[model samples]
Target: MTVAGWETRKNVPLVGHQVLLQYRKGTSGAFVTPKKVRTDRDGWATATVKATADGAYRYDFAGTSLTRATTGSADFVDVK
Candidate 1:
């Protein structure tokens, strides 16, 4: 699967920063290991994740730069 998002603060994109992609199998399931990716000039970052099984999955982003930390969630993904 491919996870992608934009990093912004106060409506401004944060460039050259790192964002972590974290995933879990189900709503009540524990999250697996996370993947780290860097934001491009447009503040967009993406990570490729390999699903372990077919199920409902969720993902979120975590990032910090210059003492500022941010977290954002993406829409759920259904893997077959």
Candidate 2:
């Protein structure tokens, strides 16, 4: 699913908002090193991952503050 864009609710300009995505085997397992991403002009970004085999995959999207994450298993097979 595509994430909605975020708007800075602060009174000042929000610069350098960093984003990280972590994927792991399970909820109790260690979080894998996430690829660095930045919010677009509309504070939104997307990542397309392919599954090597049939298994469970979980992802987390974090920024300097709280942000939404994507989850579910639907057989990821391509980047596009």
Which one is best on lDDT? 1
Give model 2's TM-score versus the native structure.
0.44
Tens digits of per-residue lDDT for model 1 on 2-51? 22333533345567666667676655576654677777776677778777
- RMSD after CA superposition, every candidate: 6.8, 6.9
Off by over 4 Å in 1: 1-12, 54-68
User: What TM-score against the true fold does each predicted structure earn?
Assistant: 0.57, 0.44
lDDT of each: 0.57, 0.44
Best prediction by TM-score: 1
- lDDT score, candidate 1: 0.57
Q: Clashes per prediction?
A: 0, 0
Tens-digit lDDT string for candidate 2 (1-80): 23333564443332345545545543345556446556555555455555553334443444334435443332222322
Which residue pairs clash within candidate 1?
none
- Identify the runs in model 2 with alpha carbons over 4 angstroms from their true place: 1-16, 53-80
